[model samples]
Target: MDSLFLVLPLLLSASFPHFTSAHNTAPPPCHFQAIFNFGDSNSDTGGLSAAFGQAAPPNGETFFHRPVGRYCDGRLVVDFIAKSLGLPYLSAFLDALGSNFSHGANFATAGSTIRPQNTTLHQSGFSPISLNVQWYEFNDFQRRSKIIRERGGVFRDLLPKEDAFSRGLYTFDIGQNDLTSGYFLNMTPGEVKAYIPDVISQFIAVIKDLYNHGARSFWIHNTGPAGCLPYVLTKVPVTAGQIDKYGCASPFNEVARHFNVKLKSAVAKLRRSLPKAALTYVDIYSIKLNLFQNATRHGFEHPLRACCGHGGKYNWNKDHGCGSTVTVKGRQVVVGKSCKDPSKAVVWDGVHFTEAANKFIFDRIVNGDYSDPPVPLRFACYRH
Candidate 1:
């Protein structure tokens, strides 16, 4: 008995290092079969200005060499998330221009928001497909996938169990435009705050509704620091010496933080209410802050200024936009200039992040030790 006890302890000691190492290792990569994205320009793949002639440049110029409707030069958060999950880049659902749905489709539109009234710099009217409408489009995709499967088509086997409740990832990155709309409409910040909770409630309800429709894993982004955005800063100017250390408008950033807090609480409530649902909050505010703090580390000279547009001091004017003409040093030159390499820049346009910034945010989400109570959506359905 004495000999056996000693051997047992030795065996445990021998295995202890291995066990510790295993525990310290990163979790296995999440293998998502499909990625469904719904949101505004931040996550939009290409769901705006296609029907109309209006276009934004430096948008999709990095990859597709032409405007692809995405508000950035290339690849938004949705694209990065999809790529991280080893899925194909999501195509725009409105892009009947193409017929590929193997990976998934992006239903996000530039200027789309959870609230009904949303606008952009161009004053482009609100998205044709609102949040509710995007949900309907998602349902349509599922229905079409089902029909294809019933026909024993190529994607038949790709569909998750219609009733098995296998969770797929759904990303929501809206609401900035809602606040922007309110601000543009001359509504007080307090009035905007009053109306935001209901917007959040409606958002949560839609997410829960999606859960009923077989979505089990949800990743929702809290609003980014909106006051820091060039458009807002320029439109709603502060006193000459009142800029924060970050050069952001304090009131607007405070509103954004307020929304993020409420959103975090809402997500927590969601986890409690739906024990089986794995919902995670992507802390975009923190990510944005980190990017700003480490701008030089990321190769950005000016985190606040954009690379494109005239004056070359701030962002290009909303009316003139990037890639337009202006006078520079007595020479008439095309004012909107794209950087030699966009990957190094923090802000691609006046509003959105560069593709590199988006990639960094994705890395932070997957790798950062986030404190904001993650519900572990990837592990929710795993059986040890």
Candidate 2:
């Protein structure tokens, strides 16, 4: 595990120097020259700091040698997905230092919602950037890409609007925050259930926006087991019986499944409208659930607890969240604490997954084991 701290930084630094220089990578058999991602922190490579502020420490301490704006301790699921497809890790389009637009640009933000003014979440200060804003940002990115293509810029000189975009894979890993935030706003399970159709409509709208721009390859990840998350458990009342054998809140997980059912149906509707598009809905919830069931076999000792955080049953104290600060002994101290080994834990910071978990999930999705229609991204992108 100690080797992770040493080896990962060297590997990442040696490869991603393009924030300051030009670079190019040959497309794999998938024929996807690039990836353009849009969502929340679940798949945000660095959208937080790129457009807003930075992610605090313990966030990337496990691997990247620093916080790279991902909510996790290291790489996100999108990072692993890119690697699986033999592509460079995607860069946030809003990154001020410059991201490698050649491989792809991420438009996801940490606190994004599917709606522009989702009243429940918005009232609770949870709606920082919505999917609506992300689409607008994508439009701006397309504009910039066009200018760069026309001018024959310093980076990825061969990529033009049609050459790179037409063959690129567009991925989304969002909607978890949109649902979870409703609980914080005091919305009941019934209320939350009623709101699923709105979420589906918004997702369809975003997909249509991308389809109009010549994008045909789509890999969309459904929300994972949010009820199983350690931090979320702290937010609500529960009985011992309510906790499942896997240590997740049964009622909350049911809500997630319910949402997925509606979302999956919506994907079917989208397919009928955009028949030529390759839309693969990945079942992230099942992938994560199976991982929880086989945690010991997968090298995770504490699958329910976070690798970083403080003072809670799951090590995710709400009063002292991961990367937060508190005054201790007349000095400012980081409130959260990190585990002895992060690679052995599935959860990170109570809410997000550890790098190890995200990699496992990505592997399952790419392998066709966890994706709906049993189609892997390799074949899905080729159809486009």
Candidate 3:
């Protein structure tokens, strides 16, 4: 943990060599009243957990001090975004218990994809709540919240104001699953590449739908380096030659890069069509890929290993995943346990990043170092 503080400065300096006091010195030019996030496990607060079951122990042990429906040991990148904007953590749209949608609601569920899979969660380990489904949830929430607020009383405080839809920031961190799902089904990288256009088209449709519903600011994150994730490394078959020096599967990363390129181009086209909207295409792939390639430099270790998994070369096993239990010699024991120090680890589970790592990525992107048009998160409402 001490190493984090020491190397964090270096990490920040390396991200933006022109880093100055002026960056943090400036105040936010505009205010985003709320944030409506849509994605998968990377930014999911509680949607999947609420519908299925809670993510087991050690999941939210870092910052929240208990399991709070986040995949990370503490908070996701979205949580940091809320804190930075002085807003409260977003409630999941599907979670009815102890929720406050006054600021905004998260429609992201773990294992979600841009294109809906035909298989069930038990069959494919993917969520039924696709990007389009999330858009529908948001559409419903937007309409019903206004109706309920008209009655006033306690309900008014629990839901967002009508104007919040237009003033809120719409964020997306999906598409990684769309690529991996194909791989899991034994499809070639070429096959996955073939469907990317359709996936991206669906994504654009949702953004346009949101725009029609009055969302003016969009903070869209292109998917991260799927090849660098332990989940992919363990699940997918790969030739040693396909693996890069960084211990990532080169072919998979190439596909991910291809997806990002298409997504960026789509976002650029969306900007011209939706003239009123401020669309920021954040290059999360580069940021995460760089972190994996230079893990030790950022005070992290085992870039390709899961901090909370049972056993394997990457400490990941599909059958006995993170939080899995087993009876060893007639005694029940938790096989998948967290590392001693999550701060020193980049990945938490095989699929998700630790809170420490999320914070690291968030800090860099908040300065617009990885975003298009070079606009900070504070001024994302402005179209460059």
**Which order, best to worst by TM-score?**
3, 2, 1
* lDDT at residue 49 of model 2 (Cα atoms): 69
Q: Compared with the true structure, what per-residue lDDT tens digits does model 2 show for residues 217-256?
A: 8888888878788867888777899899888888778888
Q: On a 0 to 100 scale, what is the lDDT of residue 150 in model 1? A: 80
Candidate 1 residue runs with Cα over 4 Å from true position: 1-29, 53-56, 118-125, 149-165, 324-334, 374-384
The lDDT per prediction is: 0.70, 0.77, 0.90
What is the overall TM-score of model 1 with all chains considered together?
Answer: 0.82
Number of the candidate with higher TM-score, 1 or 2: 2
lDDT of 1 at 9: 30
The candidates, ranked best first by lDDT, are: 3, 2, 1
How far is 13's C-alpha from truth in model 2 (Å)? 41
**How do all models score by TM-score?**
0.82, 0.87, 0.93
Per-model clash counts, in order, read: 2, 0, 0
| Tens digits of per-residue lDDT for model 3, 184-285 | 999999999999999999999999999999999999999999999999998899999999998999989999999999999999999899989989999999
Each candidate: RMSD to true structure? Answer: 7.3, 8.8, 5.1
